[model samples]
Target: MRYPILIEEGSDTTAFGVVVPDLPGCFSAGDSLDEALDGAREAAAAWIDAALDAGMPVPSPTKLEDARRLSGYEGWTVGVVDLDQALFDDSIERVNITLPKRILRRLDDLAAARHQSRGAFIADLTMVTK
Candidate 1:
């Protein structure tokens, strides 16, 4: 599912961050724009996993009428995201990965940079790993 991801470049040209508004629970960052996007995709997967695990209904993308209802709201902007159900249902294989402490730390950092919980991050990695 593709979400409307907001990307902002940091002070360093290569540094960036992304926020998925619909899934306010998810965020991501990277050393470059491309990395940020990749992180965002991972973050989205993680967020969805967590939500599903908790039995929380994932909110559908807001339509134009939904945005219109919020027109004139203060200090906020809205963007729509299109999440394909087919993409959400596609899960390939699962592999058990036991990494060293350093690599785990890096994974944690990446997940945190995206504002995702470790469980969600792991679930995402498990779902899409080739």
Candidate 2:
């Protein structure tokens, strides 16, 4: 997804500031335009990750034109950050992890008792523990 960023231009004495309108309270800063943009992308990803991990719904990105038209963003320059769609995807992906045989056996047994695969069990446990 392409999210619009508003960059507050910086001079030699100040750093560039960035804000992601779609994500409330998501902001970043850097010494240059490129750095501000990079920081914004990282901030956006981290924001999304935290929101998803907490089981909160992410806000959809407003169109560039709409974002630019926001009342307070008149003088700031705009930039687009392309976030990977996979970050928002819930699709399963195969992974390999090695565990102690006894622990693996216990996990499998518990998973079977709960009618869920070990991966699903582990995922559920992780979310709950957090």
Candidate 3:
């Protein structure tokens, strides 16, 4: 999804801030505009990951015009972040990943406790975190 981001310019006393209007609580900051935007992408992904983990419906991306209509956004720079298809992709593609036996055991136990398969449990964590 292409989510619109608002970049609030900062002066010498503060850092640039980014806010993803479509995703509440999704924000980031950096010394420069580029950095702030890079952080915003990561923030957006984390937000979606958290929502998915919580079993909540992922909110649709707000239109750019609608997002800009929100008050208090005057003079803010706008940009769009194109998220990876994997965030919404349902096709299964398997690969090998090596992990410590201890950690693997712990993961298995946790997945079982949740009444979920190890792959699903791991996929949720890895997708959000990676």
The best candidate in terms of TM-score? 2
lDDT for position 84 in model 1? 49
1 versus 2: better TM-score goes to:
2
Q: Tell me the tens digit of each residue's lDDT in model 2 across 16-129.
A: 999999999998999998888888988999899889988899999999998889888899988788999988997788999999999999999999999999999999898786
**Lowest-lDDT window of 10 residues in candidate 1?**
71-80
Give the better candidate number (1 or 3) by lDDT.
Answer: 3
On a 0 to 100 scale, what is the lDDT of residue 77 in model 3?
78
The parts of candidate 2 lying over 4 Å away from their true place are 102-117, 124-130
Per-model TM-score on C-alpha atoms: 0.50, 0.78, 0.72
Per-residue alpha-carbon lDDT of model 1 for 63-119, expressed as tens digits? 544544553333333343445465456365756779899999999998998899877
Q: Put down candidate 3 lDDT per residue, 13-116, tens digits, no spaces.
A: 89999999889889999998888888999888878877876778888888888877889899897778889867865568897989999999999999999898
By TM-score: ranked, best first: 2, 3, 1
Error of 1 at 103 (Å): 32
Sort order, lDDT high to low = 2, 3, 1
- Among residues 3 or more apart in sequence or in different chains, the pairs in candidate 2 whose N, CA or C atoms overlap within 3 Å are none
